[model samples]
Target: MSDLYEKLKRFQQNTPVQKPSPPALVPSSSTSKPLPDQLLKIPGIVRGSQVMEKIQQRDDAKKKFLSTLGVNEVTNPAGKYGYREIKISNRELPITKEDIGGLEIQTISRDASLAVFNANDFLFFDTETTGLAGGTGTTPFLIGIGFFDEDGFRVCQYMMRDYDEEAAVLHDLVKQIGRFPALASYNGKCFDAPILQARFLLNRLRFPITDMPHLDLLFAARRFWKKMLPSCSLSTVESRILGRTREEDISGELIPYVYFDFLRGIRIERMRPVLFHNVEDVVSLAMLAAKICRMVRHPENECRHGWEWFGLGCCLAAAGMWERTFFCLEQAVLEPSLSLEEWIAINKFLSLSYKRLARMKEAVDVWQRMIERGEDVFAMIELAKFHEHTEKKYAEALALTERAILQMRNRQNDVMANGPATVMYEELLHRWNRLLEKRKNP
Candidate 1:
């Protein structure tokens, strides 16, 4: 048994064990045969080479298109995904500092902080977005800003080449916006400003314009031209107010699609019109803001039409500028171009302005004129209150109240049908009874 064990150990010690070989290294390039045309045509099967080729083609097309628009690539340390900028010289645009100068921001915006800024301190801003359904999802692909410089009105457009570059665009845009003390935009308060604020919030950056004095020209445009123009959109105001029409422009509805197409690397030339449209919008914003401010400053000479006077009056009235409201309304009533409805509205506002200014005689005159025209129950009630409270003329108050009550009775069926009209009738009746008692006692 010992001899057998020694022989087995000697056999084990003398045997040579074989080591497993390492797996063979494959070449960097595959040598496998290409897939057949039929297999490659399957929905999910695409060659890596073909995918890369398409990406290269798209990148080439985008680069070529951006070059034609005179756009420059922007890089910063905060973000690697750089944005693009297109600078438009003052000579390329028709506007100048003289055109937009001499604006009273307080009168136009009614914000005293805005009063500190001159035309040069304002940034005329506009944005072209991915979609009108605004949210964080609605990205501003292009932002156009115009400002006055020693050279004149120069425009700078900041655009994101792709969705990933939005952070870079916002980073640069906040820097530019920080230079301006005031911001003016057409319909920006409702649309552009909110979307930009959301983008800044999502990018974890502070919105520079949040505390800036913002003058949304949309409200002022509506106040000045809503009655005179068919639509107070920037384009409409541009043609009607600025006396400039875009010879070549893209419709706002098609802008998003054009941007999407550009991003998809098709119809790159369509982006040119979008840039043009944005430039025009920025230019018109400055022009319209200037026009509004000038008209507000000198309504007597600037207002050419009756509706203009009425609009100015309404604006002044809203700001509680009773003296200016009276002057504008007085001029509006003198003009023959006002429609019947407009005339009645102006008269009502004129009377209110007169009352606000403590010009009771002018208020009485306006009420009498409205009454003489068609027995305006509103004017009658207003005059009755004035006579009762201010003058203590109980007989005159009773007469005016009675006339209003009679008018309501004459249209009793219509009055009773409307809830507000019924309430107004009850109020007139109450005034009539109170006035009668006062008249009898006096």
Candidate 2:
């Protein structure tokens, strides 16, 4: 055994052992194919499944989606595109022209550059898009419009079946919008109309929504309710102004995901809530339009809150409806919730409205209230003018002028007094001289 072991060791020591070669650490760029190219060719690098699986047929998916919606699918004569459309009765929406006076639309839209748009020509429009950050890639899947007809208010929704079907939907929308002279939307001027116009340009279709006047209720709602609501979203406006709350509505942010799922052969049940959300949006558009028109028409009507009265007064003043402005201001002042600043502003407007109507007594009363509250130099000047010129009471005018001069002195060091104090100071001096002259002459 010792001789065998010695021979094996000698043989192993004499034998030459060859070393294995290490792999060549070549750089990735050494390959002719790029990594991204290789990755693209891979079936599914991460998912372990086929990448870019066959997409569902556009027409078939559309049919299935429409079937779930219980809406009719329409194809143009050219058969190049197809869309879905539905018309529901006013029962679905209880708003009528009577609910919003026909004349009131004319008044409310007067300053909105809709001079020619009448109730017959006003179209309430809303859109449901695949994304809120709208651009060329974002598509409006649904366009819902409402207008008054023999059936009261009829809402017609035109929905796209697929990306290719947008042309048909836009064509139908243009035809419907052509009948109306103006479009009323919640935020259409900034959001919906621009998106539709982009879609039309992308499709190489003529965008019929010309320079036509668009009444964006968003601005109006913000002007009136910004002080009252936490946010001026349509939902908040509907709840606060129209007293309508949406229940079981899908979150707006999830709509795009649900629509993409529908395109990928997911069940249509996911899209039903989205469609219902769109429907409510359209119906609420009409109702909100009517509600705003009613508010404009009846500025003197009791408002739900003090801020509403103040907002109405401002609107009336802008429209040159002095009597109505005065009425709204009077109502606003009676509200207990009015802040000191708002109360002063309302009284100032109220005094101006009264003076515009030659109702000097009412104007004087408003100024007296301002003087009692904290003392408004402008109000004091107006009261002094009334006493001196209208009542021919120089003594009373002198007293008011002297009081305003003293108040101006008190506010001289106050930083709040900008140009207003200078103007009031000059007016007070002019009034004092005039009162002295009147006393001497009388």
Compose the digit string of candidate 2's lDDT tens values, residues 1-442: 9999999999999999999999989886684776776776765663443333334354466576577666677777423333434565667655666655445554555554675455567788888889999888889987888888766666777777667778777777778889987788888988899898998898788888868777778877876788889999998888878898777688888888888877766765677787778778877877777777778765545367777887777776777777777777888888888788878887887888889889888999999999999688778888988888889999998999999999888878762457766776887888799889989998
Q: Show model 1 residue runs off by greater than 4 Å.
A: 1-46, 78-103, 318-321, 389-393
Best by TM-score: 1
Give the root-mean-square deviation of each candidate in angstroms: 7.5, 12.6
lDDT of 1: 0.82
Instruction: Give the Cα-based TM-score of candidate 2 against the true structure.
Output: 0.73
- The residue-level lDDT of candidate 1 at 291 comes to 77
Q: Report lDDT (Cα) of residue 197, candidate 2.
A: 92
Which 10 residues in a row give candidate 2 its minimum summed lDDT?
47-56
